[model samples]
Target: MSLLLDTDNSAKPPVTTFGPDFPFDYDRWISHPAGLGRLPDDQLGQEVAVIGAGLAGIVAGHELMKLGFKPVIYESSRMGGRLRSEPFSGADGVFAELGGMRFPVSSTGLYHYIGQVGIETKPFPNPLDEATPSTLIDLESEQFYVEGAGHGALPPLLREVSEAWSGALEGGADFTALQDAVRKRDIPALKAIWNKLVPLWDERTFYDFVASSPSFAQKSFRHREVFGQVGFGTGGWDSDFPNSMLEILRVVVTAQDEGQRMMVGGAEQLPRRLWHLAPTTLAHWPAGTSLASLHAGAPRPGVTRIARDEAGGGIAITDRWGDTRRYKAAIVTCHSWLLTTHIDCDESLFSQKLWMALDRTRYMQSAKTFVMVDKPFWTERDETTGRYKMSMTLTDRITRGTYLFDNGPDKPSVICLSYSWMSDAMKVLPLDAERRVRLMLGALQKVYPGVDIASHIIGEPITVSWESDPNFLGAFKGALPGHYRYNRQMFCHFMQDSLPPAERGLFLAGDGVSFTPGWAEGAVQTALNTVWGVLHQFGGKTLAENPGPGDVFDAIAPVDLPA
Candidate 1:
């Protein structure tokens, strides 16, 4: 057994049962103190073209270099991709996390790099958390405040909604069996149970499942409405009500969204650190060589086109400035939609089925706008009223989720005035930062009546409409009903050798290509899968003692229908 799985000998993962799969003990494999296997000496000088400088690209590049391959990366934007950290203009230590703020403890794959970079973390100040201080749930023209640690009981309707969901899952989904199998890391047991659920839930929407469940139907539709308002674990599920029920099951069963923490400085530190760190020795370069030094301190230009380098038995990629380069293999870590829209990728590179999967992919829309304040005003107690000045809020208004970040009472604080999704996000897409702030403020103002929110402002606000960002068409892929086949096709793309020659050298990877989308863990996991694919293409093999997830993929790959 791997030392990582031996601590307890109970088969229970370090985190909970809800994160994506960690079949290979990746954290231990990546830092094999004794070191991982090396590639053939003759392949040491060969270059691998890496597209995108995000977490996926950087991680893939770093690991490939450890095996002696030269990785030249290309990016249209700054490093970190959607894990963006916008530091306040004049204030140090304060930042607006425009993307991926909270990370679940189950994200062991992601944590391997985080720990390697020495990033500090604290439990996210989520609603009901001890660190939250207080929370205000405003909906249906009624507002209530819960004190620090969320000690008080919630409204009766909320409790009933929770009970109904628990009963429904327990009775209809064999919830206990699923959780136990996941906790045990018993892949066969998990498949034996989940395989039956795929066909049952694949064709059903989340709303359909909820409405048809005897537990939910036994209660009034009002309870259903309440359930939508205060969803299980996470906040409202109104935006996800139309998505596939299997997606919801995957999230809950894996417990992927709970017990989350935020990186102390910012999440971007992981990739930035990997960009410069040097190993004791490198395959092609001298000791102390790093990715930054390998690329002369910058990434190559954004990729504009990709095609088969047929005569060269490799793949050719063209940059935005029309600089064409060919390589023995390449890994594409960009959003899948970019293949058909922004880039002129050759049609023959992927089969018809893969193209259908890519074209049909549905990316969710998301919007977030942040403002800096002079202090953590929300934590301040109002003397006469015995109420907080403001509270971390979740509501039904335009702003569905509002978050607060405190550097310290003495320093500038960040207020994520609005963090909404789908239709709610689209409602604020057309507004500029100030206008979005005004809209969110107007909505929040009505809820708080007397709180002078604008008075504490320290600087201009930061906002993002992922749908409006050209580089990313949407926040992340949200698989819809009957989309399981498409997801399987994308997720299993690393098995490209089964496809025609045109599809062999160019591989796909990213959150969009993962079974669990919208999570950085998925991005890292899929990037590692592609690393294995590229390695095999170069005739390299994973270390026998530290095999990758792909090495055992046949037994653990997602359940799919016959061809």
Candidate 2:
């Protein structure tokens, strides 16, 4: 069922990620004419070690450089971490989005950087989205075709499922009111509804909420099964069914799953551009100064160890080559699991409680297979039924969701043959790209018997199982039931004033540490928080006009549950 509430009022302010947890307007904070903030003169040229060259690290490094600090960025692998866009060999700039493809319009924090870098975006062709020509649903060998968008286009069973989901949200969580509060930026009301839900659902799973809700309980088991496979807004959330209900509510309430767009060229361009682009309005840096210039056009080697410098008064970072450097402050943008598994981090850097939270943080698995095609052959119409030859396919087979990317009419297009999560992802973990492609083609052959997807493919196929990557042990964080405290500890780590002296200068920022994990906006928001934390560490304060997240954190911090 459509979880989005019809609360759009043009006169009202647009809905942004103004938080159900920490309702700080990071978009406004960063976009303020006064700028993010100025650093103390003494700290202007001081180096800050930023680990990982992902979206969070690049954003933090970019902002820190603008504040006149020399941010030394360390990359373990590629530059754009999970915003990976790998180009097919011998293709004309066609990219297969390996990670972080769809971005919601409500993610103002992420868009701020996209706008800054002059990146372009178009509505992603999600299943049954207006941007998509048609959508095919295949469940239990039965196939259904939806020709358009909205609930009206869905089959009766699918529509009933959608309505039930909408009803469940309204009845259980006051969905309309909570979303209205979010759109209107009503902090009190937003907190009133969401804080109440946090305590209720933090200990429950998404599956539990769906099964027990009056709306779903009244329906047949098949209805719930369909909802899991062909979910509202996006395709198949069954993988997340075992996760905390709070996580699902956060996504629905903030519209993080709807009105999504895909970055043109590739999402990786955002970070790469931010690295090379010199902001016109920076504090201590000159006009031409950029992150690339400071780092001599490449980031430092991967970080091997992180510890407090006994000789110096701040954190010390060691590179893979055994080179060590000390920084007055440091920002770690890597996955939390990497802190324990990949990096030799000092045990004293964090309290036992915080360490427990980090060690216990859970991540989800994801896999995607993409192939460059000769043309937009899917656009061809079938003579018998007058339907598009192929469509955005959602199935329960090995290939859970298949997306089609039409570069243009004649130009080479791309198709994501299979996009699966959790168990589905693990099924092909040990397989190579060709084998995965073969299996996906076999599944699609059953759904579209008349068309041959294999014939249209050009260039080599690209596939990735993020769980297999050593640098990133999994796709992103997926908080489990009863893990609210762990999330709170990680999300609030950027506020270091109350932390012990040993952990004061070290900060964490990434999607994994955010309340809404698996979203670029979370990474952006947490990165902005890290920027504010670094400013505070240097004894700097934001201008009165633009008080940073730290300035008003106590008033709007997340609800703290009893230990």
Candidate 3:
């Protein structure tokens, strides 16, 4: 992970997710000793509806509960939402991360919670990462191997592609200056550089940025194609080619793609622990009280409808079983599209403009296939070749990226045979888990002609196409060109003082509502913003020393573009 070096002083701050948009210090705000805020005595123990038990809902509920408000969490699906980790049948702890897997160290907001939950993390084995034994890149029926760390280890073509990508970023996006400001947490400088780029790039696509760059323009078409297939950091970003350039820049500037780690057991543990953990420092409730204890060991059933409580002067949430509960305020942490397709929401809850933004929000599709192996056999070196049997593979085949996980010599290992996005993902959307595995195995066999991957398989393979799941609709938001207004509208929805009475009591919080989507840090940041909004609605204020996001929102709010 890169450190923020101070040119004048010796102290170096860690790079955090301090925004290029809002520029709020969420990590500092949450870590403050003074605590988030305090609720009015009358508002203590007042039930607040929190829809969706995902990381956002869980984080918001945990914080709100600490401040003496009773946050009733409603979950239609599992507790972790997209952080789903399905264990292999008959295995001790080996599982497949069907949702989010890799998390960057720069995601301080998320790390705070991961630390809170006491979950262990280790470096993820991305292609070309030091943590990986080796990486095999296969395209057009040709193979190249990268041993050890750094781009210099790659083959000539791949090294050229990597250098060209860097040059393109430097030439087109002022990469160094922007990342330096991000590393230093220079809010003013970050905003100045980023705000200018927003207007210039909001209407452009990531592909457009790459194609038009002087660096890439000088390179051959083959270089651009290879760059797309074996992109820097994680892997192939070609799926995001059509997305707004601003979306890609946000990830690059913040270093979201670097120094990634995976949860020890599963990403789901973070939210699950938060739900059951009874904070040592809490108000209005007993010392042993927990979110689980409040709801009798589980969250309330999935909410089917959300409408204004006309008589109660708040919001009313109706569960799938027809049980309706009223609350002084409500937070919606589910996918924005669900508000239109899954839930029956009141039309007057938001303005037509806000509705347009919500409707315009786009979600991306993703698919993953995994299997538990009998052992870490991939580590075994071939006698003749003097190379590991199977390396983490990235290709232009049906399986875009293949990842391997080694628990230990004694424990069973796991392999993500195929992790594809967009069109690649849709190819196996209708296929069963076994079929998906077969397809991926066939593709991998071409890359590793000698290795028998199926022989070591110990359990039934697990697969997920997030788009097929009604609860999720899609994997995560991928903003298109000209969708900045929609993102800003969702992101700033927490600051609702200027809104009409009907929209005041309801709020939105999740990665989709954040500038950096598909990252847990974004989910945590937005959840904190939701907490501040709920605290403010209940006449609560932060301590003088520790001001909340809502307290200083206007000053550092995201830049606005023409309507």
Candidate 4:
């Protein structure tokens, strides 16, 4: 967002998930407009192996390559990672956003790529956007439509639910104080407030906070149920019930779920563009060389093993095809569990404290199913039924949330038959796309008795169970109660000087290791953390006036690990 941009647009926000923002300026890191520091002549040709061609890996490689280092990226699958955009069998310019669909403006780090890449973004058909002119909230045989959240007056029950959540925040955490600190970017105040509450909330679940908070306690348990069923912003909070209260609070205070937009074509376009974008100021290589150009338009094979190169060399990586190469530095952007489960990583590569953090990180489950229709028939209003043909729906039925994507009135449109998480997702995990669509359509039939949804489906359905993907294992990290120390260890792993020589050149990054998982902001920011770290390892330095993150990390760093 422009909130962080300064008069000359050479600065960045002063808030970091790992702590208060770095004392140094971000503009110092980027000599070029894209944000990068120059590597010394001696460090120019150093090879930096980047594993996983996801956002974190891609961003790290893209930036490092700009700084004159050779960043060869490897991937087990496609380049976009969780930003998978699948199209119908015969349709063009139409797709099902299988993962990481909506993005909020608060995600300034990600917006940097989006803006530079020049991709068009439109309002996602969230609860309240131009895409969703109407929204239906259906439950217990009762149905109601609102213009959009906060657009018009809310129903009595929803009003009570909203007020109760507000009250709960006020009573439990002093919501206004924290929110003010967050918005004002008051690092000291935020640390002072958040540190005290972290220990208390680290041991508490979201449900525990809701149930025990004075606001919800005064009202019956029904208030909590109502809040879970239809929470403010996206939808239900129930899926996050098992996560630590700190997790939910971070999301809430940051408002990463609010006022978001979706890329017009597909969210993947940004990363894809970055891969092919030949920056004007690239060093060492030819002026026109891009990551795609350097890799010959294809990523290297997936990494299978990582070891400390024994002959006083840097790190050694072995890919799936049995090719082993040594690089000065390696950034593992793959999921954390992959380090232990799939990769043959040496135990000494990480401390037991770091290993515990990596191994115990919890991930959430998510599923989404989509189908293309002949047209946006939902825009039609039935004279007899007294309701628009269909609306962006939220329900308590088998299909929890259904979204409508209108390409145009006459063009093929997409409907997310069901976008469920946690238990709701697991319910349909066993079913194929067709069967899931059938079940979702059947469920929708119950909600809108006379509506004929199946007849409008013009093409095949697309579905995803992120948990089923071996590479991801689960959607994203959803830290459980008491996992704060693990998170702290993981988030701070970029400071390799604190580690022994055996683990020094290996860096950990990705949304998985970030403090705010499931958000691209975390991925982008953490990847930048590694870029700064790797640069420093190779004797790179930022301009003295605009120091980089690592230049003063110790002073500004937060998350003091527990003894």
Candidate 5:
């Protein structure tokens, strides 16, 4: 159960999942220092243990190693925790991303991480440019409206409205002027400026603020659809800027070009590559062993165990074997509700109290369906409108959150369609695997008729009903009214614990801590920040200081950039 090191040091070529076609030479990129074996025992003993192996955990470990701290990572499951990407064998071995899929170009840190690992990403195809003659349907009215190629039809006033707002927000205009407008409570003018400022509002819960918006009551725009687009930002609820919906929006628009790229094999290829990237720390170290009984801290050095705490820290993290692991410090890359149980904690360690009051937080419910057909059905359109690539349809009538995924490149083509109930405040349905797949296929058929549902479904569908998965008790996290204060406090406390000086012997890193969410960027950013916090604790400089040019955040402000 434990791995103890016998030799002074051992170096080996990194194992990789990528075949020869991969762009970077993994062998050349990762090197084991030749003289590392000569270091004294005291030097080697200066160790840090990271408890999770998801994106955040891996990044944290990589960063620590770079700083000369030999990081020992402990995880109950396989590495790449929530960044779990699996290939569906039924689709002619063509991969469908079961977990975290897309990344935005705006995530400079994530992009850099991809590069560091020597993995390549291409832009995800935009669904707006295709001509498959797709239309948003309104079931109530029995009406359907088609969008023209390139840009769809927009209300005359609304067109100018959106343009003006986007210009101001992305151009970096100050929000102080907009704050003045909101303070005055001028509804029309406020609506004009609201779009520009939503990015900064991540401090506020979307459900509360949007529900209270005058626009929501007046039906000024396709509010729910717009909200969904905005919400599906960088990483989702785990993002650091939990209240800033617009920052999420910005990640998507920017990544429209970059998100189009997929792995040469599929998303699953990346995780498989990560697994082979480093030798299992468990394999080489004698003192390093799997923990069986979960404790605040246990087993001296090599002994570790999984134990269930009556109260959950975040949703209890179920190990790879489906056992629960309690924690003093946790890297929560999973869904919010999974860990949001009303568990009491030591006041001194988790004084924020929000951890105990998670029942009050609101989360949106969503369903996703993936289908592999003998041929691509969406041949009607091309890369731009999702007719051929990815597309979204919004009309006066259609149900919201319905869309098609692009699975054109692989041998057995596939398409992913999704639907969500943004305003529905209901308990997530806990369905067994058989029932979950049945509902998913049923929903997909309702959205796209004439498509052969049974013929294309080569195997059982992979379903993630946030309601059932213990690791992710619900979908993503959402803020509630006045909950912003609690959010900030919770994150600050967690970040502080991650600091090397904190002596908590625990660390925190994940989607919940990054500045953006609903995507991989947030997780990666938080991971990077976790490293920075850890390094600062060990008397090391920030990532900017240690990683050279690849640093995501500069010590100098953007304003300091030379003209």
Candidate 6:
């Protein structure tokens, strides 16, 4: 029989229940000194609770354990929210990233974590610098022009857009200006750049805003503009989305300035290794208990009540059956908007301004499609053209996005890979894998020639629509122009109204709070900085705020995503 620790000091009264899968292996858990089981429940005082088992929460819980703090993780779904990989049995038993692909060197902590876990990284393909001649097509004009490889492969209009974008940044137009303009509903600024800014929000439809723009209308060669928007909105003919053309453009430009890097085996390898690094911690971490309720009493300074059942010292929590347990301090890592919609938090507990800001921010649209081909068709070039390019940039005279990764880098004989971005338009499509593949292939045939892309031999495709995922409605929170300023302080002020300062002791971590705000590195940084922040609270260690979120978010290094 395992010894039970007292849980009397629980601020939030819990409705406890016990079942077959309740209490876990107490003996094994005892070996971990920093583990939850080792902490006397009376001293630990109900323990810190982390909701959402995604990387954000997982990493946060791990850091807490390292700091002699035990955290009970509550997840409504299986692990790895939007970061996942699919395994395909082929010649080399290869795998492909159906979710996230690469992380650059700029993510120093992420690289370190990968290295600490023995995950290997590989050099990204440098086709952009490979001197391969490729054709740059005007999607609107159907007028094709060829560039002799390298950085010059971009179409004339695209080159202009890039130059103009760079000029805008160099001229002191920062994210703050854009965000402020959006917040103030600065009609003039928005209207001045309405041609560029409206498309960022309106790119979900099949219509091509770039082609419709007065700028494109004046040009005799605007006919191909629809394809440009198709290319841009969809992250190119073959990409994945709900990410606007503007967002995709930002990624590309950032990649060009920052460069691309990836794990040699696959992206999943990193997280898988991290899970194994602290095997005892992950294997014994408590989960599977549904937070049946969030009982909110009268609000107190810096505190709120979040009640739960079938957790704590009860069942094993593997099969969804468990002993009901309770926790007081919980930091939810799921969608904030969803939190407001589904669960009730103390309205008086959250600041009125923060609540209003959260209400105004729209949900992000995210989807992924993975296509497996017998071979990388892009590498199989035209014998007549002698071009060995594996991918091309899909752009209108305006926006650009979409990418093809070589899933066969280690196994060329078996699986090939491609992805497309359709932004919010994917929401209207059937969410099945077949329809996704057809849509991707249909888009692909529209851009490349018959022998080049059309009628290309391929295998089955797998698509994951994150918006429909039970645990998460979207990939991440969309920080509108001014939301960053408004919500940036939410982390510090979230617990201002709670009692006993329970939340001050509880840590907050998530990409939504990060400078980058939407990428994997931002998620990692959230965890890293979270640990640093908590340690600072304990008078342990601290991080320099010199870079600041805005600078870090806009920081550009070299990237290898190709031009």
> Global lDDT for candidate 5?
0.40
Query: Which tens-of-lDDT digit does each residue in 370-488 have in candidate 2?
Result: 99999999999999989999999999999999999998888999999999999999999999999999999999999999999999999999999999999999999999999999999
> lDDT per residue, candidate 5, 1-563, as tens digits?
00011212124221121111011111222332321112233333245555556676666555455445555555544555445555566444555565556554434545555664468665443232232234343333343344542222533433333343333333432433333333343334544554434334544543434444443444444543343332221111222233444433333233322223454455545433543343323212333222221112321221133222336422223333444444333333333343434222233333335454334445544444455556555545544434422234332211233444445643466555443333321222555545644655564455545455566556555544544444444455545434444443333433353323322433445655432334555565455445545544444433222242113222211111111
Q: On residues 1-563, what C-alpha lDDT tens digit does candidate 4 reach at each position? A: 11111123234333323232222233224444544667889778788999998899989999999889989899998998998888789988999888888988767678778887898887788764555777888877688677644623567777777777777777777766776676566767877777778887888999999998876887877678877876777877899999999888887666676767899899888778999998877789888989998899999999899998998668899999999999989999999998998899999889998999899999888999999999999889878966787888888887889999999988999999899888999999999988998899889998888889988888778999999998998899999999988988887788888677887999988988887899987888789889989998888876665566777787567557467
Local accuracy of candidate 6 as per-residue lDDT tens digits, 31-84: 334432233233332345665556676665555554445556665655554567
Ten-residue segment with the worst summed lDDT in candidate 3?
1-10
Q: Show how many residue pairs clash in every candidate, following the order shown.
A: 2, 1, 0, 2, 68, 52
Of candidates 3 and 1, the better by lDDT: 3
TM-score between model 1 and native: 0.94
lDDT of 6 at 532: 40
Number of clashing residue pairs, candidate 4: 2
- Model 6 compared with the native: what TM-score? 0.62
Give lDDT tens digits, candidate 3, residues 493-534: 999899988888999999999999999999999999999999
Candidate numbers sorted by TM-score from highest down: 2, 3, 1, 4, 6, 5
Which segments of model 1 are wrong by more than 4 Å? 1-25, 31-36, 150-152, 280-284
- lDDT (Cα) of model 6: 0.43
lDDT of each: 0.81, 0.91, 0.90, 0.81, 0.40, 0.43
Of candidate 4, the 10-residue stretch with the lowest lDDT total is 1-10
Off by over 4 Å in 6: 1-46, 89-93, 123-138, 141-150, 153-155, 174-257, 279-305, 308-324, 341-349, 393-402, 407-424, 452-459, 491-507, 532-563
For candidate 4, give the lDDT of residue 253. Answer: 66
Give residue 286's lDDT in candidate 2 (0 to 100). Answer: 81
